[model samples]
Target: MAGVAGRLARRWSWSAFRSPVQVTCSQAFPLHVSGTAMMATQADFENAMSQVKLLKKDPGNEVKLKLYALYKQATEGPCNVPKPGVFDFVNKAKWDAWSGLGNVSKETARQNYVDLVSSLRSSESTSQVKPGAESQQGTYETLVVTSDDGITKIVLNRPAKKNAITTKMYHEIILALQAASKDDSALTVLTGNGDYYCSGNDLTNFTDIPPGGVEQKAKDSAVLLRDFVNCFIDFPKPLIAVVNGPAVGISVTLLGLFDIVYATDKATFHTPFTHLGQSPEGCSSYTFPKIMGSAKAAEMLIFGKKITAGEACAQGLVTQVFPDSTFQKEVWTRLKAFSKLPPNALKISKEIIRKNEKEKLHATNAEECQVLQSRWLSDECMNAVMGFLSKKAKL
Candidate 1:
């Protein structure tokens, strides 16, 4: 709480202090304009777009409309498309903006737009928009908290090691979630870096946990692990996951709790609990059987099967699977649109969906924690883990 307030206050306060370039592209009768080929080329259009992106502030909606009209006129020659309906103010404005340019040559429209950007650029000084105008304010050392346009993205940052979640990272992620829940943000996106979403708990930290009897189990950080997973169960805002790559261990299981799951075609989700002599941790013990049926959940937990992105989607674990190349951009654009909805409505809707299961989810988490802690010190668990680590070392 208090932490969330302080961090977000500093994070969002600077968004207003910016200098945005002004754009002018209004016409009452677009189709009536004179058609002439100006000297402006494709290079000019590219430069203007780049400059517009570099402005300290986001371009206004009107400017965006002009940019679209100019782009269409420049590339396609003219608006052959029919005007939108009178009720559709948005498309109507856009139609008049372009078709009204009626006979104007594509190059002429391009030249005027390019000249507009140049003039705006000349008026604003470099000092007005300094490099790194956005401070690394809410940014964490092991977690990336990127918040803009009412959505926050928490990217797991340990990409070099498949974005493995370390103890420190778990704590940082917990804090990030807490902050996002209390903040005005309408949605939060969770994903990992590099070629994997998250490899789950970093095994390096498990080296010291003695492998054997019930007496030695208490020393392991299983309780902390349980608490960390609980964070996902209680998240307030809409939580979405982008499974960018391989998701191992608890990472795959947590997908059951996300409001939406978007995965890349290259992604593989594996819950190798049986292979590791462990049990489900993230309430998958309850969620999986319900979401994917008892038979499928048994196959995943007992057999440790590797579920492909497509398989996960078919099993109802993933909301959608996108091509690896376009995964981020496609998911991000949709999330931004989702973020613009009525915030309270979204929250209440989510609450209603999870309403019945919320308490049982917590109870199951506690039950699963007890079983996992006991399993941690069992003889079978030790042999399995050591063998897995040994093979990993050989690789």
Candidate 2:
């Protein structure tokens, strides 16, 4: 929410948000465009932001997110929040863009951002940015999104850790999901890169959490979780999930919200909420019972039961399942077929189905955050998480 917080706090100044770029640097600076006029002053640094904002050309999402980060850096200086998860390519990129300016004075970031945009504007051969340089806009360090035709696939790439969801990764997924909703050219498919879909929240995220008292930390963490979960709940397009393997924690609970779920024979789902001595985060407390019935939901959430794909399907939690070896191929074909269906039809149908649940989901989200704040602060959870970490280190 650091990047988001900056975005939401906008004063939307006209000079920055709406201005004409025709005004040359000569007005605010001592010298030339390509020459010694390259020297710029503080006023010019501020003016450059306005000039860049007035560019006639569309710089695309990558450049846009970069500019946003740079503008924030120039105005706000170093990042004050935790780096977002690697899965959230947008915020991660923005964080990197802003974070890289660390040690750079706010005045300097403004000047450098001016220089960067000036160089970009002068390029005529192609509008496309240089490879790797565009990565400044964001990096998918733990996730990847690839598209063929109109079907886009977002993969959780941290297979070595069973695709564990880290703090940064959560932000990336939310950003990607938000992008998917607005992407008319692509319908999204989410799944894992290897053996497991996701193994739940990364323990290291706890370590990386902003330093604060237990209550403050819980508030921050709960707020982050609420935003992430809400992104999934309010997404404005058809969302499909391909469960290639086992999943745990919010990853398992999230399945209740997908429009359709296709799983592999090896796919299983688990939520270790009670086992971890914590409460649920994905609003599964409400969604799970509604989707799979109260009794089955209790068996899974309360007992932390491991649910096999076949069992999940029988309980109506899974839409379909395919052989493990051919899971990707089968799901790909099915999604492509789904892509062939009228996209607007799919969109409208999904909206209609989800419309009724929106308020309840948001209400549940608020309640869950309050409860989670308490759970996270409690001694039971503190001991449980530490015990797990201790054993993981074989200490």
Candidate 3:
């Protein structure tokens, strides 16, 4: 509730509520110049405004302030309103942002807004692509894998489904990891689109019984699962997990494989394997205990405990936790800087650190998948999954 209030407060001001001033762009910014060029620019500016609403991710506060300043300047001509008081931080920051524009003409501000929007859209497009520099496979349906600015980023793209990992997603992810390993990027980052980092395996994968029945389905799935996890274990470069929001099941279990995990205060980590009558995967059985110790790890993997970002950090799962409002800006800044380091140096260093555990992780992964194959064929696992899906359909 406090977080909700805080976010609302940041978005609005007491002064705005007390004395509202509304100005439409067309009314305030009357054209000084005549002709098709001015009319075209105006249309483009309005189009840019619409495009801003379509952006997939927040462009951060600094960019938002610039946009606010430009929008106000273009429409209202200048910041004629009285400066907000110091104590009214939200209003004050807004006032400062607008007032800092310093009497720029409305036409220039409109053009600038259009240009800024264009730049932002372009950057976003580049950030979401397949990893290999020369590869033709630059697009994906369930994932975005790009190598740029010294970092290879793998973004889970199923936002409407809370970034759930479908069978197709598992294959794409494995391919992305393989590409990232050979890419020139200094590091690799794993994250997600929209609210969730990942909600874990799509339960629908269980319902679709194949030609060979449940036993064959389990065996085939185990192979894919082993290959998927081995990609993480064998990754040569530094692997980072940016936990933007709540993560569950395999998503939370896999964090222990990452070299660094940065999370927002709003993010949560949970391994609810037991809830579905399943045991742990993603080498969490080995890595979780090593990071969080046996008892705490058991609380999560066995008993289905969910921990907040702070608790995850305290237990050595997450490297750091930042305020939810500042998380993306702060984490991306550090990641970009980290990516500037020598690529080979970072890769070799990560390889050296992972060398001792590589064999053990592979062994653990094999054992876990072998167990999961058997479990998947069990009536307990089948009943639990079916019940969950039944409840979901009702919801």
TM-score per candidate: 0.64, 0.66, 0.66
Of the two candidates 1 and 2, the one with more favorable lDDT, higher being better, is 1
True-structure lDDT of candidate 2:
0.69
TM-score of 1: 0.64
User: lDDT of all predictions, in order shown?
Assistant: 0.71, 0.69, 0.77
How big is the positional error of residue 280 in model 1, measured in Å on the Cα after superposition? 1.1
lDDT of 2 by residue, 149-176 (tens): 6776788989999999987788778656
State in Å the error of residue 59, model 2: 18
Name the weakest run of 10 consecutive residues (lDDT summed) in model 1. 27-36
Give the TM-score (vs. native) of candidate 3.
0.66
Distance from true location, Cα of 55 in model 2, Å: 18
Q: Considering TM-score, which of the candidate structures 1 and 2 is the better prediction for this target?
A: 2
Candidate 2: misplaced stretches above 4 Å?
1-138, 209-212
* Candidate 3: tens digits of C-alpha lDDT, residues 89-177: 65665677778666757776676566566556754675576433323335567887777798888999999999999998987787677
Candidate 3, position 50, lDDT:
73
